[model samples]
Target: MRNSTIDLLKVLASQIIVIHHLLLYTPMSPVLQAEWPALLGLIADEGRYMVQIFLVIGGFLAAQSLLGLLGKARDVAVWPLFKKRYLRLAKPFWVAIAVAVLLGWLSSKIAMHSEISDLPTLAQLLAHVFLLHDIVGVEALSAGVWYVAIDLQLYAVLVLIAWASQKTGQLKFLEPAHALLLLASAMALASLWMWNRNAEHDEWAWYFFGAYGLGVVAHWAQRESKIVLSSLLIACVLGIAMWIEWRERLLLTGVTALLLMNSAQIERFVTLIVQGPVRWLGDISYSVFLIHYGVLVFASSVVIALGLTSVAEMLLAFVATWVVSVAAGWVLHRVVDR
Candidate 1:
């Protein structure tokens, strides 16, 4: 069952991320930055952090679908779940990479925007194909692909933890499922308090697991009996997380989790306002996220080649890029993702 609220958040977050990338990488952005410095800076810099919304939503849905409430844990087929996740992510992702490689090469022929164009070596291609580009120290072929790899890693860890807990005997102080939940929460807290603070470790799943785990806890909160326990768990970890070192991203994560936990009960008027476009955008969002950068690279390179320098030209270029990227993403979804 598709929750209109989840779809709404997904669409909003994905669009912001798309705009954020355009502001960051388009050759035209620097031209306009002089005129609208604050607007461009906020969208380009602060907007990238909207990704925490995606992480939270992904974790919530994963737990709701795969694990269910602890007392009634779903008997998921572990290997098949992982397989479905990989194939679902890989199909669109590999297609996007191919498009990126083609555009990257074509951009090299036209013009190379310093940040937008990077010709891929064989090693880089291999690294990206295996979703190990970050660990392999190969520059990414597309913007935000690292999140795809990290999402998969986080899902695998959650699945394994749930699966392993089922096999173990109950611990002295807890039921087996409770023990499992405790273990997962501990890892999340450790990540929030320790690994997430280090910029060097951003490539790893542990660095983002806290936000993801909050999503899981939020889904578990839906049942009346579990609400207090789940909310307390969230407060304790995120509270400590804030105490350790405050981050706007962590705060956003908390807000997103709380909203998701109560999304089903949102007032009807709000749904009427957002449901239509949000659902449509949500349907194509994965495609939008995967394919937008490739389109941007090609579009920005064209803008550079044409030597379009005016503020008017930059605005036109930015609008054109947004329209084309969304159109391409919609097509990609229809042709490949379905």
Candidate 2:
């Protein structure tokens, strides 16, 4: 069964990201901005932070799936894991890229805008196909595609770490699982202290490993006998990291990790708040994230073509875009992701 709390976070973050992109890329936003600058500004400024929720949760779920609470490296067939993850992310991603390209071409015929990508070259297309667009310095065809690439990289890193732990498991004092946790914790500290502090590293998984590693640690902590100590150590390390240099994203990651450590409470809380629609949205969140940008670009282009400027007209257009994005996401989930 799916964890309801993780699903809740996914639903909320995915919607916020969709709205954030809408406000960022849509011409209708300027009209709404005139009417409600504060609201628009708030979403534009803070909504990006929702990514931290996904980073933490990705780490949590990856750890749970790959290592389990016991940290057992049952089948560290790294190549198979990597192939499965890449295919899972890339299949829907390729479809979304097609959607983005088609809508971008159509939108250009109506009204040219910077949000629409230029026609991709063969090299750029290949880069995206291999999830190497960021590493190879090619611009993405769709918004938020970088996260998909980074997610794959992070999983590879985790799998490699698990494999290494298995190879070194002959030590009498430390089992492979314990060693895996220690290695992950060490990497997390390095990320939190060094790599994450630099903006230049943002394109890579190492920069985000602190948050991801926190999720891994939180998962293992639940099964450890020294859960309280583990939790305290995590908080103390994060506290020191913040004390050295304050980052709101890191703070959010820390909070997410702490909540995930007590996920039973969170699951209970979300059960009270999450209904059928929310659960459904959460199930299709990946589809929504992939397809919404294309839908938004198309909707905005139509609004621009119609010269929609009135506040009511703009508001209606924005609502229609959101609804259409959700509907498109549902279709993509059914046809591609399912």
Candidate 3:
């Protein structure tokens, strides 16, 4: 069966993130508040957490997929594997960066209603182009680029972790119980280190490398061993703790769910929800992630052009943004994802 739960989580996470962006277009500034802004802040903050969920899923799938490839191949070359992973992440990434930069630059100069300063400048753009900005704690050129950097890092981390596992005879032993404990200890120490570091920075790094690695650990644990509740608990606690800052909270949430092993409640609900148009959105979720902001900015401009300043027009602008952007994303995905 498909990983329906993860699919549902991906869809849910994207919607939460998009809605969060929608809120920013309005005057409901949740992050500016001291006390929690209840649903608004929670929902808006979901962009980060949802991305973490994506990371966790990506890490597990990437590693598992690579392992399968290696198992089937007699003499696996590292360069090809690395290149494959890089292309998978980097191709759409290249398009996304170019488009985001162009849109941000254009909106900054030409578009009347826009928020392009949030995007990177030339120097920052270079850092992002090289995929090294987040490494040195530099901000992204675009709003959501740190995640890109993190995804790349997690790719390398997964490779190293898998390599080490095979070399150390851990993969051969398949005594998942022992591996689970060792991983648990490692994650605990990492969490402690993060807690000691700046929470904000730690949040970003953890989401990038730490959380995804933890997911890899979980997938390995589940596949190689019977079942373990401890990993889930750890991921859960970390996720709840992450609500204060990083998006890795959502990754931790995925890990928590994965640890549950079997849950009818989640399985049935997820299957039902991911039906029809919702699943169609899942197919175009990448569009929602990449072009939604650009579409929203343009749609706002269109509303202004039409001289339709009503609340209904604002709502229409938002809906039209998703519709148009999703179509563009589908066409773009076909061309660029190759």
Best by TM-score: 2
lDDT of each: 0.82, 0.87, 0.57
TM-scores, in order shown?
A: 0.92, 0.96, 0.75
Candidate 1 regions exceeding 4 Å error are 69-75, 116-118, 169-177, 267-269
- For 87-132, candidate 1 gives per-residue lDDT tens digits of 8888889899999888878887888877555667889888877789
- The runs of at least 3 residues in candidate 3 whose Cα sits more than 4 Å from the true structure, single-residue gaps closed, are 26-42, 45-47, 66-78, 105-110, 117-124, 136-139, 170-189, 192-197, 200-207, 228-256, 259-269, 303-308
Tens digits of lDDT, candidate 3, 1-338: 56566666667767777777766763223232223467666766555666766766665666566555445543335567667776776677667767766665565554466455465657776676667776666665445656666676656655554444445443477533344335533653465335424556542434345546555555555555534564556556566556655544544555543633332336776777778777766766665576566655555555555666455555566566656767766666778863
The model with the greatest lDDT is 2
Question: Local error of candidate 3 at 96, Å?
Answer: 2.0
Q: What would the per-residue lDDT of candidate 2 be over residues 162-233, giving only the tens digit for each residue?
A: 887776766666777877788999999999998999989888999989989999998887656456787798
**Candidate 3 local Cα displacement, residue 338, angstroms:** 5.3
Ranked by lDDT from best down, the candidates are 2, 1, 3
lDDT of 2: 0.87
